[model samples]
Target: MYQESSFKHDAAPPMEYFLWIIPTGRASDAYGYSQAKTPTWSDYIRETGNNGADRDDFDDAIDFMAWFVYKTHKVNSISKWDAYAQYLNYHEGWGGYKRGTYKKKSG
Candidate 1:
């Protein structure tokens, strides 16, 4: 349930992502952490390149994501919780997400 844009490491921010960008960062407040705010690619600055130039593939990402979903508070213990809820918790702050803001969405 990880989310991210398709912007490349060296690509300039596109207009479509402007609304997703927060103050000097993405909606998740992940600025310098992610390469171009590409959601699926987690943060690991001081590395070689985008998602790192070395370690090929999503193994690192998958491992980290597993830990994130299982270790993060609130999102883990919520009843009937699933990847969708976890995604909401991840995108919105805990307080905001716990308010059930997404329940009103048309989606």
Candidate 2:
């Protein structure tokens, strides 16, 4: 999340991400300190019953990240201590990671 948003509550992706990253116009609806996408954020709210959570709120952001990490581990059997794998999961999403999409990337 820090790498995604630089710890800024209002961090947003650069214009090019919106212009070219996705054919729809943006990489995702990711925003704020956690850079959480709308669908995932909504899931967090639904799963945790944190209906009032805000992306720009530090506490909410941290809690959202923790929940994502927990879910990543639970759904993917990824060790929480595995930062590299966790990071790939974070960026690629649980399903994407499970599908081994990261293996196709050159980086």
Candidate 3:
């Protein structure tokens, strides 16, 4: 839905605005942040433990989106969940798209 629209449309608003719509925070008794706690992009990243690193630059945007969706939806796979979380954390503050690993063009 949102992910597809974001990826397919060039005129779409920046990912930051879309990400802001998702909530973030923790309810009492919750062990981790929730959609309710995320009010801003920075807040979401901070609460999710994405501290921003160079490694995240190499990941596809779709991968990030899928991981974000999975986290927001509270999916069940521990490995997938952790992998997404780590990726998010690794690439937090960086912006702009990087070429896919298989792309012929060099950055």
Candidate 4:
């Protein structure tokens, strides 16, 4: 998706944890943009925070999106995806997360 690519290029590279952020951005965008007739994953990333003072929240959104994508696409096993989904739920209070698998979360 275009949005996924934008988040990867625009947001992921600047972070100390680029791998972590990409999937979060993707998942958050997937959920947040679902209502649109033509939703973009990037729009979801953009919508997660205000212009300022919510950078942490924005980061969390990115992780959430990434987690969503990881669960849905990259891994082929339901058990693995469920574990990831649980991890995201548990880590919602923080902006950081660890990847359970090494595969890139997006296409």
lDDT of 3: 0.34
lDDT of 2: 0.88
Instruction: lDDT for model 1, please.
Output: 0.43
Which residues of candidate 1, in runs, are more than 4 Å off? 6-57, 73-76, 79-81, 103-107
Writing each residue's lDDT as its tens digit, candidate 4 over 1-107 gives: 22423433323222234576553333332222111111333433465543342222445445545554554433333344565554443333122234434233444
Quick one: ranking by TM-score, best first? Answer: 2, 1, 3, 4
What TM-score goes with each of the models?
Answer: 0.40, 0.86, 0.24, 0.20
N/CA/C clash count, model 3: 10
Each candidate: RMSD to true structure? Answer: 7.8, 3.4, 16.0, 13.6
Best candidate, lDDT: 2
Ranking by lDDT: 2, 1, 4, 3
Clashing pairs in 1: 4-39
Candidates 2 and 4 compared by TM-score, better number = 2
Model 1: lowest-lDDT 10 consecutive positions: 28-37
- Among all candidates shown, the one with the greatest TM-score: 2
Q: Of 1 and 2, which scores higher on lDDT?
A: 2
Q: Indicate the residue-level lDDT of 34 in model 1.
A: 22
lDDT of 2 at 11: 84
